[model samples]
Target: MKTELLEFENKHKLLEPTSTERVATLEAISEYTENFLGNIDTLPAFVNNVSEKAPFIQSINFEEQNTLNEVLKNIRLYIDTPGINPASGGHLGYIPGGGLFYGAVGDYLACITNRYAGVRFASPGAVLLEETVLNWMANLFGYSKNYGGTLTSGGSIANLTAIATARDAINLKAKDYHKAVIYTTQYAHHCLQKSIRILGMDDVQWREIECNNLYQMNVEELEKAINKDLNNGFLPWLLVASAGTTDVGAIDPLQQLSEISKKYNLWFHVDAAYGGFFILTNKGKQLLKGIEQADSIVADPHKGLFIPYGLGAVLIKNKKLLHKTHQYLANYMQDASTEKVDLSPADLSPELSRHFRALRLWLPLKIHGEKPFENYLNEKMQLATYCYQQLSNLPDVEVFNKPELSVFAFRFLHKELPLDKYNEKIQKAVMNDGRVFISSTRLNNCYVLRIAILSFRTHLSTIETALTVLDKSKKIAEDELYQELRNN
Candidate 1:
C-alpha cells in the first residue's frame, strides 16, 4: 500500500511542471500570441469555406499525451483559423467584445492564485477587490452608497439576477405569476424573456410597447398599455428599457419611461449590456441621462469598457433586496458565515464558485486609466456616424435610423432582383470577401445589413475598409444576379 501511494504521488507531481518547463511553455505561448497580434491588422475578420469535418475535430483525444507545440498547432488551425476572428479589428458584426492584453494578463494572475472570491472569510482581499470594482460601477451610474452589485459571467446572467431580485422585492409568489405584468419594447434583449421562463414566470403578461420610427419606445402607447392592463385586473410589475439595443443601437425614451414606471409603481430595469459603460463619455452621459434612476441596471465591461469577454455587472439601488433574493446557507459553508464589512458576492448572485472576474477589469483600469476607454467609446460613436453618412451617400443604398450609439441598419436596392434576395446576395458576397465582417437583421420584414462598432481596436481606417468592401461586394452581387438571369 505504501509503494502504491508513492507511485500515485509521483504521477500527480507531473501536474505541477518544473520552473524550466513553465518558462519554456510561457515563452512558446508568448511567441504565438505576439505573431497573431502582429498580423491582426491584415487578418480577415471572417474566414469562408470552412470544412465541416476539420482536422481539429478529429484531433480531440485525451488517451494520448501530446506535445505543447502539437497542441498549439491544433488550436491555430482548427480553433482560431476557420471562423470569425473576433480579435481582428474588422469584426463589425453583432456586438464586438474587446480583447485587451492587460485583461488577459490579469486573468492569468487570477487563475494562478485561485482565490475564492465568493466568500469574504475564504479570501477577504479578493472579495474586497470585487466589491471595489462593483462599487465603482455603481457610483458611475449615479447610485447611492447603499447600492450593491455582483460581477457575472456576462449580461445574460446579470439580467437574470436583476429580474429575480425585482420579483422577490415584491414578495411575488408562484401562484400570482399569471397576474404579473412586464413591459418592454420589441427590441429589448431576448435574455429577459429567457429569464422569465427560467424563473417559472412565463405566464406573466408581457406588453411590447410600440416604438417610433427611431425605435425609441412610444411613451404614450406605453402608458395606454399599462392602463389597459390595470383595467383588465393585471398587475404592472416591471418595466425593462434599453440604454442601447442590440439591433439598431436605439435608446428608448429613458427619462420618460422612468417617469411612467414611477407613476405606475413598477420596477424600472435598464438593459445597457451593450452600451452601459458609454456613461464614461460626455455624449454618453447626456444620452443616458435618466439611467441613474433605474431600480437595477445590467452592464457588460466586455462591451463598453473594451475588456475581454466574461465580465458583466448588475447594480441594484436597494442592496437588501438583492441579498434577500440570492442569499443561501449550507452546513459546509459555515466557516464563511462570519459577519464582515462587505457583502459576499455569493449573497448577491446565484453563483457560488465564480471565477475571479474582477481582476480583468481592475488591471486594465489601473494600467491604462479611464481616459483611454472613454476616448475609444467616443471614437466608436463617431465612426458609426461616419459609416452611416457614407452608406447614405451611395446611390442604391437605403440607410436606416441614424445611430443612437454605434449601430444602424441599411440595405441595397436592385431593380431586377427582389429587394430581400438582392440584399441577401450582397451580404453573402461581403462575408465571402472576408476583409471585414458584417451582420444582418430583418426590420419590418425587410432584410438589412448591420454594423456594430464597439471594439476598442476598430478605428476610422477599419470603417473605411468596410466601405470599400461594401462597394466591391455590391458589384459582385450585381454581376452574379445578372449572370443568373441570363442563365435562366
Candidate 2:
C-alpha cells in the first residue's frame, strides 16, 4: 500500500497550483461567503447537535476544503448575525474596514515579533509605540506638555488609575487623613464607585450629586454637596465629572465642575470614557466644554473611534500626577536616574504583560485623518437626535432624557399598565422577535428603554428599524390592554 501511494504521488507530482485549481478554490470560497451574506436577509435559525464530532485530519489527507468550509459555516451561524445590543445599544457588530484590517494585521505582526510591551529595556520600540499613542491622546485633550496618561483595558481600569492618582496627590499633601470623599454625579458610571471601593477607603464619602432636567450634573447640587462636605470636615479628594454619562449620554457641566474643583482644591477627573474623542466634532467640542481644564480625563476609542474593544485611555493634565500614583521602581523595571521619556506600559498602569493595543488606535488616526472621525461623530449625534424624534412621536412611548450625546432613554407609559411587569414583558417581546435589540433602565421611578447609537455601523436605517421595533412593542402592549379591558 505504501509503495502504491508513493508511486501515485510521483506520477501525479503533488498537484501544483494551476489556474483551474485556483479558480475552483476561489469559486468555492465565493459561494460560501455569498451564501452566508445573502442569507442574512432571512436571519434563519441554525440547528447543530452539540455532540457532533468532526472528522479526523489524518483521514482527509490533503483535500479537506469541504470540511474546512463546513467548520467556517458552522462558526458563522453561531455568531448570531446583526449582533446583540451591548448593554449600551446599537450592536454595530464586527464592521470591516481599513482601520479594523490594519488593527488585525498590527496584532499579527506584534505576535510574530513577540514584542514585550511591559519593560522599556526589553522592548523599547513597543514601549515607544505605546507612548507615542499616549502622547497623541494627551495632546488631543489639549493637555500641556507636562500632562500624560497611560492606555488602559477600559473605563473601569482607567477610572481606577485616575482615582488612584487623586489619592496619591492627597496623600502627599496631607499628613493625617481620617476621611476621604469622592464627588461625582448620580449618573456617573458605576466604575467610579467601584474604583472608590477598591481603593480600600471604607470611610470614603460619595457625593452623588443629582442631575438636572437635561440629565446633566446639577452644578448647584454639586456646589452644595461640596460645601456640606467641607463644613463637616471631610476631605474632598476627587471631583469626577462625567463627560458623557452611561445611561443618557449626558455631559456634565464640566466648566462649572472645573471651577468648583479649583475653588475647593479638589482633584478634577473627567470620565469621558464613552464620549471623550467626540472632541473632534464641532458639536462635541462645544458640548464637552472645559473638559480640557480637567486634571485627568478618561476616553475610550472603542466607543468613539469605533476601534475594536480592549482600548481606553486616561489623560492627565500633569504627567507628574501619574508618577505621584504609579512611581515605583522594581530592580528590573525602572532606572530613575536615566530619565527615560519613552513610556513602558507597565510603568503607567498596574498590568505588566500588556498587549500592544495602542497601534489599533494610532494606525487608524494616521491612516484616516482625524476629520473623518469628526464627521462620523457628527453623523452619530444626528442619528441619536433622529431616534429621539421617532421615539417622542409615538403615543405610548415617552422620550425621558434628551440625549446629551448618542444615548437616550425612553419608556412605555400608560395609566393602567403596571410599569415593572409591563416593561419586563415588552423587553422580552422585543428580544424574542430578534429583528433588533435594545436595553432597559429604571430612571426616576419608571422603567426606561435605553437606545445608545454610538456604534460606527449605526446608520439611519438601523435607527429607523430600532424605532419600528419600539413602535411595534408599544402597539402590541396597547392592543393587549384593550383586549383585557373588553374581556373584563
Best by lDDT: 1
lDDT of each: 0.91, 0.72
**Deviation in angstroms for 54 in model 1?**
3.2
Error of 2 at 148 (Å): 1.7
**Per-model RMSD to reference:** 1.2, 7.1
In model 2, the number of clashes is 0
lDDT of 1 at 238: 98
Clashing pairs in 1: none
Give one digit per residue, the lDDT tens place, for model 2 in 193-275: 78867876545767778888887878888888878878988877788888888878888888988999999899899999988
Instruction: Name the best candidate (by TM-score).
Output: 1
* Clash number for candidate 1: 0
Candidate 1 lDDT over 226-290, as tens digits, reads 99999999999999999999999999888998999999999999999998989999999999999
Give candidate 2 regions above 4 Å deviation. Answer: 1-74, 77-99, 172-178, 334-343, 478-488
